[model samples]
Target: MSVFQSINPYSQALIQEYPLMDTGKINAALETAANGYHIWRRMRFAERAGVLLNAAKILRAGKEKYAQLITIEMGKVLPESLGEVEKCAWVCEYYAEHGETFLADEQIIAGYQKSFVTYEPIGAVLAIMPWNFPFWQVFRYAAPTLMAGNVTLLKHAPNVSGCSLAIAEIFKAAGAPEGVFQSIIIDVDAVEKILSTPIVQAVTLTGSERAGTSVAAIAGRHVKKSLLELGGSDALIVLPDADLQKAATVALQSRLLNAGQSCIGSKRFIVVKAVLDDFMQLLLNGISQYRQGDPMETGITTGPLARPDLAANLSAQLTGSIKSGAKLEYGGRFDGCNVMPSLLMNVQPGMAAFDQETFGPLAAVVAANDEQHAIELANLSPYGLGGSVWTKDIDKGISLARQITTGAVFINSLVKSDPRLPFGGVKKSGYGRELGRHGILEFVNAKTIAAEL
Candidate 1:
């Protein structure tokens, strides 16, 4: 059997080790998930909602413990880790409160005695989650999936295996029946076998483009439904008439959040020529305040990357972009897993920093001739994830926001995911939606029932 270890990125100390589940154990989990699906699909909406609500309570009561584990395992600052846990609880409660209504039958206007479309669970769904926001990502998918009456199996990132098991326990303690939610500590090689199983109905993955493509291909070959949220080089467009201070502040906060590991975080700052210099100054001022140190320390505003390799990769991207004509305006030094918050100016379309998804605390600034050019620059990427348009004129911001092709676009605000809204991406960023009514319906069978008696 193979073993994997989780180490603190900040301290470089081993936290825990997990052994991979063998083929037999993986097969058993599949069988149990299949059985759980049968039981879960027949459960009432209220019953499932009860389980989710209980899970929310558990999450809140154990927030500190879970938050500490998140910080230790993934190197997110303690406060952010706590916020992630709270957000998980909020998602659980959100789905519990609204899932049934979201999945309720819709009346059809067909000329029959009775006609309607019913949403029903497809069966067991396999959620292949990432480690960046381990708890939030899983709950955002699982809460709605389970509340919609589908059992699920999880294949979380190896580095966050402890989080995977903890999530399984959350459901179990919340009164979920056997196998309703199982997290298997298996290697990537085992995913195909599980997906190939007849009992597995669909798959959802939140990871890199490569991983999403592979999983989508496997799901396609197996004829199972798939939803993917892949990598993004999200743009934050600052119009000439925008509030420079606010725009620069929000942009820095978004790019630096989670050490810049978020897919929705503003990776590129597209500023109009009129305010480019001013915005750059404000942005640099904000960057000067970011302090990287022990994630558990309250005074530290930034933490280490989840791994040292990520820091190295970010450094390489910076170097490539600079060679391609991007000027390093500020920090670009790396120490182990810690990357000093860096800024690159004169970033153009073809540069690595502009074109590729830089997954650390590095910010790229691109100058645009005008508003039209700003929108064009925003849409230049193959990634159509989340984006934002900043302008003092709310109406102008709204109009420009419509021009940017992405899953979600925010006007005069940072791009974020909300339970009340649908979230996903387009093009190479992956497809299908999650959250709100659209999310719960993703893995469901929308059966049209028409009858004349």
Candidate 2:
């Protein structure tokens, strides 16, 4: 058995090492989750909701410790990691408060016939999450899935093994049954075997493009449900009449949040010619002011990439962008695992950074001739996860936003994952949502019941 070491991205200190699970433990967890689902799905809506609500309280009471583990494992700033924990709690409570109503039986009129749709659990759901927001990503899926009467089996990033077990413990403390949600310490190679099991009915992944494809293929082979939130080259569109100052500020935050490791983070900035200069200036100024050092420090706005390889890949992407005619405006160098926030200009369509998802502290600026060009450039990529269309004019911004071929678009705002609204993307960004009513319903079997008149 191989024991993988977890390190703090910021301090470059080894946190701990865990022996990878063998076949026996993986099979046991799968069996447990499958068996637990039978009784879990039979529970009353209110009863299930109570488990999730209690989990919310458990999270809130221990937010500081959970946040520390998250920061130590992945280099998320303490404040931001705390915010992630707080958000996790919110997701838990949200489902607990509204799940019953959301999943209630729905009546429908089919001409002369009457029909109703009843939501039912789909047994054990396998959640494969990333390290960027370790706790948040796992809970975002777990809260709703558990509340929906389905059991969850987590396969988290090995680097964040402690956080993974911590999450499962919290749920257990909140009155979740023995197998309601289990954290499996298995490698990617082990996923297919678990997926092949009889009890695992669905899987949801928040991970890299490669991981998404691998999991999706396995899930497809088994004819199971899959929700994939894959890589994104999300565009931040700034129009002529846009508030340059606000746009630049939001753009900086959107690209830099989670140390620039988010799926929906803005990797490309599409600016209309009229405001290109102003937007570029503001972007440079904003990037310069970001505080970077130890993430454990109270004021640091940025942290190292989750690992050294990620930083190296970021360097390669920046180098490739420069080679492709994109001008490196600021912060193009990488030291160890810390890559400073970067801004690239003169980005053309064919450049790797312009079209591909740059999962680091790099942003490519593509100047557009007009609104049509901006929209066209934004849609040029094969990935269409989410984007923001910035303009002061509400009607015009909303109209242009509607035209963007992304899962979600914001007008005069930044792209975000909200539990209240539907989220996911089109094209190669992968299918299925991770938030809102759509997310809760994603893992359920939507059955239609009919009664003869």
Candidate 3:
């Protein structure tokens, strides 16, 4: 009886209302997905790839439309929204082209005359995704899972319900069979019930640590495999020998992109004390370039926070950190969800901005005594989804990178997720991996077969 409403963050206007699926509809969807999985799993790898490739084609053809939907629905700037669509298409194409090779049987030398490991689909997989990068997150999981021969059931965030349905429509238009990919318009309770079903075999989530823990617990209870890509307080380490200009440029972009809603966005800037003042000046200048306005406008560099609550939460973190000794360097002005690009200096381990994930246009700068201290400060966070170490010396950078505790570390570069690399995190950031060969294999049954010649 309850209806879900989608609101445009920028205009604060109601976009659409979706009625919840009742028990009967939910049962029917599960049954359909189960049936589709049976057919999908039996198809040749080439055949499966063909459908995914077609989906990619559809995404490309409708890029503009989907980009507009993303901007209007979630307040992503127009350019970034378009880039998100392009990235989603890229993932689809990447998986369509390489998934079969990644999932191929591996030969093993053992006592048995013939032995091999085969990857087999594990029926329907439930994907619970977030809204920040709505399309990209879902496609990143779906492209590989579907290509690996498993059908997908997406439980996307409620705020991006329209984008969710649009993605489902794209798959259908690309000739995906009825339940190969279905977007369920349901609540959290419905998600738990669906996961409890026998047909849904596994789960993958990209959201908060709290959400990941809850879903992981449910999956554990049912003995279903789960992959979680949760919250991140990624540290951007800048050493004395690093290029401060380049580091500042990339750091600001990484922190401010998507209005700083990204999980892997650099939340803490760990700078060596020798170059702290210089890097601080560059960081301030870099932050000055961002201009927040209507996301649909072309020249606008940033947009409003996805929701008012998110803005308020980030504000609390900012005020709390300032009161705790972190000095406000620049830009802390906010009206509703439209927050100014802000920077906090002299941030220490105990400050709220340093301790918690500030998911908005706020950057925290923590001074480190030296290279070793920078690594120490970077590893100090409870959440370690991703981190980057900036240093001109490759060997030193690589050495320090190994010592940092995180999912993926980049040397002299920003942290990002690519279809070619396995991405995830340790600590409270969640477990398991997504993307690359590891992702396709995550939801599959790696059965070992041995036989006598």
Candidate 4:
């Protein structure tokens, strides 16, 4: 059988090895999931909530332990890893508290004497998640999925196999049924086999554009629902009236969080010419403060990319963008997975940094003549993920925010995912919302019933 090794990205040491499940094991898992779904679907909403609440307690109790796993396996800074674990617990608690209300039956006025719409579980859901924000991504999906009475099977990124198994243990410890949640440490080749099986009723993927396309196609062929959260080149627009210092700080934070491996991180900075110089100076100051070192250290603000190939790919993008008329403003060097928090100026539409998703600590700045031009520049990308608009005028910020062609927009703030709000993207960044009331509805059946009195 094949094996998936979990290696520490920083130390370059193997931490653990997980054996990939064979055909027979995979078949057995599917059968178990199918049976688990039946038991989960029949349970009361309160009972389901109890399991999730227990999960929240468990996550908080073991926050440090779980956080260490994330940092060691994925190279996220220690503080950020701790934050990610806390956020996972929050999502579980959020769904546990509000899931019943979100999926409550809706009364409808129809010609029939009685009419209503009921939300019901479909079956087992397969989630194909990425390594970046591994814990947050899985819990955001699994918490709601389980509360909605659907079992889940996680096919996490191979590099984070240990995280995947640990998640299974969380559910198990929280008193989940045998098949209610399972993590299958299988290769990409097995995705099709699992999706084709009758037990999996729907699918969700958080990955690149290529993976999203392939998974969506397979789900379509099987007549199952699919939700995708793909790559993004989100724009962060700074207007003339914006607070240059604050904008620069938030921009730097968003661009460098998780070493800029976030799909919704502000990859493009569209600054109005009136305040470009001031904003750039402040941004440079913040960049100077970042210290790259081991992720486990408390003082180090920057960590290595999750893999050497990722750093290499990011280096190539930086080189290609610089060659395509983009100027290297600051910091353009790589030592293995440790990037130098590079910044590029004079970036245009054709440059690789502006056109493609730079999944590293590389920031691209594009100049705009005015607010109108800034809005226009932001809309030029095929990605419509989350973005932010900075302006002193709240009304003006709201007005300009409406013009950006993205899924979610914030004014004078960094773009982020919240349990209370819906999150996802449009265009090539993929489709379907992932959180809030909309999220629990994604993999459920809205059955309509009408009857005479």
| Clashing residue pairs, backbone N/CA/C < 3 A, model 3 | none
Relative to the true structure, how large is the alpha-carbon lDDT of every model?
0.93, 0.88, 0.92, 0.93
> Which portions of model 3 miss their true places by more than 4 Å?
none
Selected candidate, larger TM-score, 1 vs 2: 1
**Higher-ranked by lDDT: 2 or 4:** 4
**Worst ten-residue run, lDDT, model 1?**
1-10
Off by over 4 Å in 2: 111-114
- lDDT per residue for candidate 4 within 1-453, as digits (tens), equals 499988898989999899999999999999999989989999999999999999999999999999999999999999999999999999999999999999999999988998999999999999999999989999999988999999999999999998999999999999899999999988989988999888898999999999999999999998889999999998999988888888999999999999999999999999999888988899889999998889999899988899999999999999999888999989998998888898999999988999899999999999999999988899898899989999889999899888888889999998999999999999998999989999999989999999996
- In candidate 4, the residue pairs with backbone N, CA or C atoms under 3 Å apart (3 or more residues apart, or in different chains) clash, namely none
lDDT of 1 by residue, 360-447 (tens): 9999999999999999999999999999999889988889888889999998888988888999999999999999989999999999
Residue pairs with backbone overlap in model 1: none
On a 0 to 1 TM-score scale, where does candidate 1 land against the true structure? 0.99
TM-score of each predicted structure versus truth: 0.99, 0.98, 0.99, 0.99
Evaluated at residue 82, the lDDT of candidate 4 is 93
Report the error of model 4 at residue 444, Å.
Answer: 0.5
